[model samples]
Target: MLYRYGSLIHRRARLVLVIAVLLIAGAAVAGAGVFGRLQGGGFDDPGSESSKAQRLIDERFGGRANLVLLAHATGGSVDAPDAAAAGRDLAAALQREPGVRDVVSYWSAGVPDLRSADGADAIVLAHVDGDATQRRERAGQLIERYAADGPALHVRAGGETAVNLDVNGQVARSLAIAEAIAVPLTLLLLILVFGSVVSALLPLAIGGIAIAGTFAELTALGAVTDVSVFAINLTTALGLGLGIDYALLMVTRFREELGEDRPVAEALATTVATAGRTILFAAGTVATALTALLVFPLYFLRSFAYAGIGVVVIAALGALVVAPALLAVLGRRVNAWPVGRRRASRSAGTAFWARLAGAVMRRPALAALPVVLGLLVVASPLRHVAFGTPDEGVLRPGSAGRQVADRLATGFPSNQNASVDIVLTGPVDRDRLAAYAQQLSTLDDAALVTSSAGTFGHGTRAGEGNPALSRPTGERLTVASRLTAKSDAAQRLVRSIRSAPAPAEAYVGGVDAALIDTTHAIGARLPLGIAIVVLATFVLLFLFTGSVIQPLRALVLNVLGLSAIMGALVWIFQDGHLASWLRFTPRPMDTAMTVLMFVIVFGLSMDYEVFIIGRIAELHGQGMPTDEAVRTGLGRTGRIVSAAAALLAVSFFAFGTGTVSFLQMFGIGCGLAIVVDATLIRGVLVPAILRGLGRLNWYSPAPLRRLHATVALREA
Candidate 1:
């Protein structure tokens, strides 16, 4: 099948090139519309209990207050004449805005909790009326208008909407910065490895097609679904990296075949059947791993699955179809303008790999133990790893939204700005409601609780009922807690509130409640997601190797390498090592980011796994002895793997310079994983395990062996 495709492409190389150019140009133009269609936040599980509560609240009440305007007095207390006038004006201005509602402030309501302890800062709470995307848009406008220092009062926006805007903006900036740094460095390295300026340019062409194509896909997907803007980052990095990886494999094989003086068509066909087949298997493994993300409820994670699977398929197609068409057209000009003797350097590097493989295979178990132990030690920190949702804290301290959050956390006592909003539906008995509200207010972390019955503090009725808390169908209560939002303590508060006896159909929906539900939703679905990844990988790899044992070995080594990387992330991001240098807060690992890292790293590990094992399997198929095949295969593929992994690492590690902590962890972890796997795991552990397995490395059950014989594409 591959040979026929390559031959057809070769015969029609010029027509193929012309057609591909037109299609990709169209894709580029369509892809330019993608940004306008993308959204800001998708981290919440919309069907969880918190979501249900939110739905009920939006239906029963006006809407929950999700935007906070922090009004600060530059010279005096908020109650002073000038500051009071400014606070009232701020509230009135917000109330008059088109999409702003439920406006309440310290000056108008005299809510003690809305005033800071020092009396210099007061908060105006309002509900931005719209869907998540629209709310962010409305909030952005309000922030620009009001969230600035003034002669009388200073105001800043903070809350769900503001945080979403900041995160999205940071991601946009991170992508630009990462591309700005990675692209030039990658080109320089590609030139050094390929030993010619012409050869280096080919990968960029492949990458451009992959990225442009995936961007078009995202644009179409975004038009109908909730796609996160963050997915754009994955699309850019993976598209370019995969482009280089597939190009290096294909070009190297083509060059080798051409050296045998084969006709251009014959050489191209051989390259497709060989390197092209490997690219197919590699793309399958990557897509299979990413498909598991669809099981998660969060669109934030699912968006990556869309972008990742699209990039893999598009990049692989470019590598197979468009790339071959280009190569066929280029013919011997593909090797034009050489900078140095590329073949001689590869030959020298191959010899070094052969010696290293021989030394390891000679004493497989003995040489493997120390390396295995060292990796286990690197993975040890995962034992105590913690996880949290990304918030304003993920942004740099200087970010506007983050600064507002910082002030809210430290300056305020207890306010609805950071509270568990519990709505009671169906029927509300006033006396029972008062008792329930009192029960919540008496909890250790509950600083105050207010309902239609009255406001309570420490189990005592401290104020009259607020009309906003009452409704015809039921009553709503706001629990102003002492625990920080999205914290372990805050999550505990949610559990306590849920566990507490209720007077009616109580629905808890707030930042803390949402966090608890999001965590639970992910945990409940994780096992199935993991099962899909493991089972699918095992089957695909078995198909590739025709051996059950080889897949098992690959899976083990990949997991080990990924564990070491995850543990390193825990030590650095979660445990606060290099926090100052990375310029991120030391907190729990972002659960979504951790899951993303694992899947992506796992997929990429399979990428290198396919490259090395494809060569080893081909040599073995030619009746080479096990020891000879292991040494020769490592010798042949080592330089390619090293160079490819280095280029890919450059693409990822540039994100380490980002101000967003989660992206920093993601970039650094993935880049480090690639480097470590290409060197230690691929170079040392693989050959040692192969030597230990001997002929068993290719062993399969009789049924599978017969099946393999029927459909094996082992060589070009």
Candidate 2:
């Protein structure tokens, strides 16, 4: 396979180069027109409990989803006529702004009920179209324009739209900070591994091209749909990860041949045939894992699924196709600045992996027990993991969004600006509805209740069952109530409300309720996604390795790594341990994080599976004894695995510097898992199992044995 493909590619180098270039160009052209307004179907407008509360108001009052709440007080008497006059002026100016569909201050018609009895503090709510980004910019302009007015009103914006905008800003800046660190560090690591500056740069170049192409595509897609900023960061990270990984595999193979004294063209051909083929399988596995996310009901998960697929495919193309062409052209120049080259006479087959495998074989049970126990210990924290939506605290505590959120929580219901809506039927008068609303308000969990008559206090909205509810029109009445807390508390409140005996023929739905439903929906579906990835991985690996047991072994080890990592994240973030030291606040993991973790861990685990299995398979194909093959294979691949793991770990570690809680958790979890998987599971336990199983490692039923001979992988 190697000689034939290498000869063909070398003979048609020009044609291969031309074809690769054209493919890349075509992808780039197709991706170029994607802009913010023309986004792909994957992007969605980020919705939260706060946004849902605002939506309740929109549905009830015919207003917009965006709101702007202003705090007004003069130096001395806030109740003075002048102060009130100034507040009204500020409100009027806001109402005049473009896209300001409507605005209501204390003076607005039918709004005096919102004012404090003493009139010392007041707020203005505005309705607007578009996303939080546009609305937030408008809010800032409003604040800046109103801050210097007479008597100096302290105007601060607090609402779902505003907070969403603020969070978006923080996320964007944090990604910039992370990229600034990870990209350069990745390049440096690649350079160090490859020896020459040029060789090291190959990964960066390919990754950069792939990312550029993806972003351009995303931009065009954004024009027609919403694209979360987080997707951008995710795409970049994945592209870099896979690009460097593929380049490393190919370069390592190329160096091995050079050491064997093969001609440059022959070495390039062999590297492409062997390493290139392995990359394809590795990429196939990763893409398969990522594609599983599409099965998730949420649009957010599907978007990332596509993003992951795109990045992995592009990286594989760079490695399997472009890399060989470049090597063919460069020839001996590829080693012009060889840095980590081992002496030609000393084979990687002589590395410490053989000794480690021997030790593991001698104590298979003991060796496997400790790694499993260690992972279990690390995984203990996962039991304490609590799920919640991302909050303002996920951003820097000092950020505008954080400040505003704090103010709302402290001065109003803990779940102020967040509510659940219930629509009831039958002939109910204002008094009955008011009594019902009041009853809801008095519930231990309710915060501030209100209705058509007036607000109970903060976030509680009293229901106004006017003649509308009894009329033949069958008017829809929405009951809104804010909880005293976010996350679990809010979810509980929604559950209690749903379970309560309300009027007959009533339907309940709000942001909190929706989130609760979403959470449950995703949680229920997780097992399905896991089963798909695990089952498919087994079938694929079973076929690839011709071993019935190896695939199961891989699945068990990967699960151990994942569980251990999740537990550590739970202890570190959910429990708030070491959060201060890391300059972050611990918050519950959101649905998105859980889904993402499953996908990323599965894909990453496959990289190790293929690398280790490829080496073992190669030795077996050469007719080596099972024990000798396992030992030699471990020895040959250990350093490369270690190096690759280290590079990925460092890159992930860089993300810990981010302010976002999920990103920080991701950084630590992935970094720690990679270390454990590379050093312990792969290095120690895999060898033990292979040794204990002996010939079973290569065993396949007669029916499948033929398939292995034909479709089974040949070593790259």
Candidate 3:
């Protein structure tokens, strides 16, 4: 199949190139509007009870406050005439804002929960009415207009909309900075690796097509469904990285074929036939791994699936169709413009990787034992892994939302800003509702519980609460915890609230509730997600290699490499190692980001794994011994793998410059994973393991062998 495709490219190279150009041009034009179409947050499970609770609140009550304005008396008590006047003025202005409603503040209701313990700072709660995109836009506008130090009240913004806005904004800026650092460095490194200016340009062109095409896909998907804007970062990073990966393989083989003195047409056809098959298989593996994200309900993970599959498929197409055409056209000039030397990939059997493989094969057990133990130790931090959703704390210390969140944590007696909201859906019994509120009030961390009946303090009815809690069909209850919402205590309190007997059909939601629901949602599907990735990857590798043992070997090493990366992330990001240098708060890893990083690293590690194993498989099929095939394959392909991994690592590493902690963790983790995979896993473990397995590496049952011979994906 690939041979025919390659033959067509050889015959109609110009036509293919022209078509690719037209498509890329069309993609760029359509993709320009993607940012506007994309949204800020899809971290919540839309079908979860917390989500239903939020929707019920919006439909019945005005809606739980999705916006918070933390106000401080500049020089005196908030109840002072001047400070009280300024607080009321601020609330009135917010009440009149176009997207704002349900303005509740200390001065407006004289609510003790709205005022800080010290009586010097207070909070204003308002519901921002919109979808994620609209809410963020509205919040940005409102914060810009109202969140500043005034004559009497100094206000800062922190809430769902504000935190999402801050995260999305930081991601955009981080991507820009990452690109600024990565692109030039990648180009220069490509030139050095390719040893020619002309060869280096092909990968960039392919990357461009992948990115533009995926952006166009995102634009279309965004218009109809929920798509996170964060996917843009993945589109850019993975698109370029995969482009370089595929192009490096194809161009290296093309040059190797041409160096055999074959004509351009024959060489191009062979390169396409071999490398094209490899590219397709690699894309399938990556797309399969990324497809595991589809099982997740959160559009944050699903959006990455959309972008990842798009980029991988498009990159593969670019490599198979566009790269071959370009290689055919350029032919001898593909190796043109040598920088300092005309050095290209050599078939010399004495390369450093070849010697390393030889040494390892001589003592596979000795080489394998220590590296295994080291990765296991590094991955020991896995036991301490914990997860939470992204919050304002993801931003740097001085970020506006973080400032508000910090004050909410320390300045207030209890953070009313992080209330656990419950909504009754059926006809309400005021008696049962009051009883429920009293029950909620007794929760270990509950500070206050407000409902239509009244406010409960320590299981006792205090006084009349916000009148807004009452509605015709149902009632709304807000429970404020003394502990911060991200805390274990807060999670426990939320769980207790949900378990407590309710007056009617109740849905519990808020920061703490949403966190519990999100954790549960992701946790429930996590085993299935892992199963899909693992089972599919195992099958794909089996089909490619026609050997069960090979797939098992791949899985073990891939896990080892990824385990170390995860441990490093937990240690550095979660445990606060190097927190000062990175300028990010130490907290639990973002559940969604951690999953995204795992699949990305897993897919990409398999990408290199397939390359190395494919080369060895080919050499062994040519009648070489296992040890000779391993040495020769590593010698031939090591430089390309190193170069590609370095460029890819640099691409991800640049994101470490961001102010957002999760993204920074993601950047550092991915870069570290690549370096470790390339050097340690690919460099040391693979060779040692292969040596240990020997002929067992290619073993398959007779029936399966026959099946593979009939339908297997062919080696390059």
Name the better of 2 and 3 by TM-score.
3
Ranking by lDDT: 1, 3, 2
> Per model, how many backbone clashes are there?
0, 30, 0
Residue-wise lDDT of candidate 3 within 1-716, one digit each (tens)? 67777878989999998988999999999999998889887889999999998888888787778788988898768998999999899999999988789998899988777788888889998999988788888999999999898888888888878888888888889999999999899999888777789999999888888999999999999999989998998998899899888998999899889989999988988888777877878898999999999999999999999999999999999999899999989989998888865453343322878988889889888988999999999999989899999888889989878888888887787786577888887667777888888988988888888988889989998888667888887788988866876798888888888888887888898877888889899999999999999999998888888899988898988888899889989999999998999888899989999999999999999998888888888889889999999998888777778888998899899999988888888889989999999888888899998888889989999999998899986753
Off by over 4 Å in 2: 1-5, 18-65, 72-82, 106-121, 131-151, 223-225, 339-350, 413-415, 423-439, 452-482, 501-511
Error of model 3, residue 714, in angstroms: 2.5
Q: 220, model 1: CA deviation in Å? A: 0.7
lDDT of 1 at 90: 91
lDDT tens digits, residue span 1-716, model 1: 88888899899999988989999999999999887788877788989888888888887888887788888898778888999998999999999999888999999999888899899899998889887678878888989998988888988888778888888778888889999999999999888888877778888789888999999999999989999888898898899999889988988888788889999999999999989989999999999999999999899999999999999999999999888988898888887788888777768878988999999999988889999999999999999998777788898888878887888888888645458888888778888888998898888788888888899999899898787888888888888875677877778878888999998878888878887888888899999988999998998888898999988999899889988898998999889989888888898888888888889999999999999998999899899998899899888888889999999999999999887888888889989999999999999999999999988999999999999888866665
Cα lDDT of model 2 by residue, 139-258, tens digit: 566555653435546766656566666655656676778788888888777766666776777667677666766766666656665555566656777777777788778877887888
Give every collision pair in model 3.
Answer: none
lDDT of 3 at 354: 93
**CA-lDDT, candidates in order:** 0.88, 0.68, 0.88
Q: TM-score of the candidate numbered 3?
A: 0.98
Q: In candidate 3, what residue range of length 10 has the lowest lDDT sum?
A: 341-350
